[model samples]
Target: MTDSSVDYGAVFKALVAPLLVMTPDFVILAASDSYLKVMGRGQADLLGQDFFAVFPPNPNDPDAIEDYLRASLERVVATGERDFMAVQRYDLEATGRQGVFEDRYWSAINTPVLGPDGEVELIIHRVDEVTDLVQQLGRSGERGVTGARAELETMRTDVYVRARQLLDVNERLKQTTSALQEALDRQRRFVFDASHDLRNPITGLLTELEVALSEPDSDLHPVLRKSLRDAERLNDIVADLLELARLDTATPTTTEPVDLAHLVMDELERRTLTATVLTRLDKQVVVCASRIRLARLLGNLLANAERHTTTTIEIIVTTDPPNAVLEVIDDGPGIAPADRERVFERLFRLDDARRQDPGGSGLGLPIAREIAQAYGGHLYAADHSTGARFVLRLPFAA
Candidate 1:
């Protein structure tokens, strides 16, 4: 399409927030209304301006432009491909009242728009502000780690200073430390579970409220849809927080004879997953486990695969006599060997696609593993050639 055929100015204004449309040479073509609203910039000021000059590279990160935003735009221009940054601390010039540059963190993706000849034309720079999350994690993490380390160091110094006098008390001290460590672990788990449990009811309340507000007969419709958006976001966060809490509690799950193959097929039929399935369990392979819990576990894994990859997901199920082995394999970017273990850690989130996703709780993997453990089964990530492969082994009943 010719440039004159379309009103690019009006089109970009309707696009999402924190967005910028720029030329290959770094000229700002159009900034969305939402972006202008958030960044406190006017269309007149930004139009025809050099993007790099408008929003300079964050001084905090010396390589923000050279290695990041500018470089990403350059790549899109050169190769006509999209580049995503999971999380980056890229500061932006504070406009309007602030009137100074502020420390900002973002999860951004740069995409290219190709011309009729398949050459890159315009670059779409989109970002989600995650400065709050980064700041939160940094503060809590510092306090916890520092406090724990300081306490341990104090204990060590005391032991060292009284090495000779404390010889008899060494055994007692070792016992005390071990007990304290156990109590600390339990306390941490309790705190996590309590917070999550408290959030569950609150989320339920918000969900009901949202539904009430969304009714056709509701009089609050004119209040604007944007006002209730924050409530919905809070509900999502609370739900995710609750998912991980279940793992810390020894809540009883009612077990029954569940046909793994049938249940898997049932779950598969409920949704549309773009994947080729080769079902080997032609016969019913029953498992003695909590049907609800297993369904949740399997559903989480399938949803995870969908979130991580767009390519084919391979599903394999078989019986090894005493145990039934099920594998969910995908052809997306696989997890690193070093990170496989940490991927299951509580509150652990990998990237923009996984953690930053509005629906993700960052508790799916951990909860799934916990459910498996409860059933006397093991769930773990295995070595894969192309993408991620999750294996679940449970005692077979059929």
Candidate 2:
């Protein structure tokens, strides 16, 4: 070729993809400008070099570049068809600008070129730079699944730690509640026991003083009698306090049928007071309750009415289908509207005009209420036409 033609060939070679023409024995025939740049060498340095001599085959690995090249040539010659490759990778020498010496895999294609005589004249090699793609795939495969597994482990540990903290807080709350309940129970028992122990001594002293005040010839007899009466009232107050404390401490025992009408009649007969006592009781109104507790409940209400009323104390006992009601109506000055609920509280006395009336410890209604509730009943005060009406309601026996 002329010098002008050769110059044109070199210009064309630089424009093409990395191209190489190889001999049948795998000897280098000619290389393009792009091929020379990949090998990190000049055109003069690669001229006439044996392809396998420059790129040695790894004997321990059978599917090397040299083996692939021989197989392609053999297949093409035997079948009389042009052997072509879609894409592959070839390791090339590193240049100073390449930064490091590493095995570089380049995507490439190889095809057997045929002459007019139908003989395989040369093998054309075309390549592209694909080292970045290969390296990226390798990194993703190495770290993909491991990162996900680490994230899952961290989530599981967080859940377990939070659950343990919640359980610990719950256990502490349970212990605190138990301690508070025990303290309240102990305080209740202490009040009951102390009050019970004081009653006997007070009772004996009042009895002796009453006997001494009965003598008519004594000089200071009237004053002594007044003092004795005051002491007896104080003793009654202490007795009421003791009963209230015991009610607070005591839990309910067995419950059975109680005759409501008989309980009220018995309490009235026991008092034997001359103040007119009236009763209207249902003959067979039975309630499920502790018998002693029910009697005490009725007795407290009757005594309260007797203490407050001037002349007439009326008791009415009635029964409905599901419940029984015992109402004590006293013709005393009625309780104020605002003081109704407060009257059922311990030591809470109404400040009506009848506050001057005598002989009440002010705990009777509260004790009656506690007893009623222990038997699954309720007690309250309702408005009456000209008096105070206290009502006790109990669930009827099944």
Candidate 3:
């Protein structure tokens, strides 16, 4: 229809969403019927009134937004441009089932309507309710923090998946370009896993025999009992090897807030450690971590300290923003500066007469570090006066 024949009020009212048209002087010209219904305003009261007059800025708005709409509209009229407002809480009077007045979130855009002489004649107001996304974000704070963040991750994950698919094409074209060291690493991982898998049954056998020995008058062989103890130790080495192998193919770890102090205290209780242990754990410190792996990681540190030190052991848990740190300190000879890197090597053994009594298979540090790295953490050795100090650092869970 021609502009002269068209009923702008009828057309705007027929729209489903809340929208309005206002003259350059900010006088409300027309509003959608739905807009009035949603806003709990009568057309008679709104028409010919300032747009802000009908729905004033909420007194409780944190942004002090009373002047925001007015200022934005002025800018749009002057520049003949479109103004978009960020998602914000804007309290509005209830319409139908809604209460008298409730705080609601909305995204709004103000567009200037120009006249035939290229002067601003009117403003078109379009608003969208975003209360649902805001509520969802508040409830599931761990998910992409906000609605926009959650949506962003979904988009990123899709792009990442597609990019990963491109690797197949690259593989065919760059078959010879594949890194040889990666292939060697894979081969090494396979050997370690294979050996551990084969050794697990021997550990199981020793455990059963130990159980049999527990029963008095069972006439279990003395030689077999000794062998069982040795087998048990070997089983430990194999278990660590298996853990290292698992690290070679670590999966994305799903984490929840874990009480660092509680986990460590519980582990200490289970072991009933003989050494004089001192703990300086902050009860409030927590980390995003896999519960099972967190326990295992702490347990390994305790075991290593206890095995090497005859004196006191100190356990300290602290937080460094973005990371939660657990330190295990013992009163024994500390690691040599040169051997730092070698200690984390799978199946590596320390060369020290004082540290050799445990006769461990050298996989403890490797496995411990493996678990740490799997969860985007780091395990490192540091020199301590009395003995060795090992530090574990993991990211703070959101």
RMSD of each: 22.9, 35.1, 23.1
Per-model lDDT: 0.72, 0.69, 0.74
lDDT of 1 by residue, 197-316 (tens): 446545655665677677857765534453355456566556555655665577676789988888888889987876665455545677888888888889888877877764677778
lDDT of 1 at 200: 54
**Candidate 1 lDDT score relative to the true structure:** 0.72
Q: Relative to the unseen true structure, what is the C-alpha lDDT of residue 165 in candidate 1, on a scale of 0 to 100? A: 40
Candidate 3 displacement at residue 97 in angstroms: 88
Candidate 3 residues lying further than 4 Å off, grouped into runs, are 1-178, 182-220, 252-254, 353-359
Global Cα lDDT for candidate 3? 0.74
TM-score of each: 0.46, 0.49, 0.48
Q: Give the TM-score of candidate 3.
A: 0.48
**By TM-score: ranked, best first:** 2, 3, 1
Clash pairs, model 2 backbone: none
Please state the error at residue 224 of candidate 2 in Å.
5.3
- The clash count for each model shown is 0, 0, 2
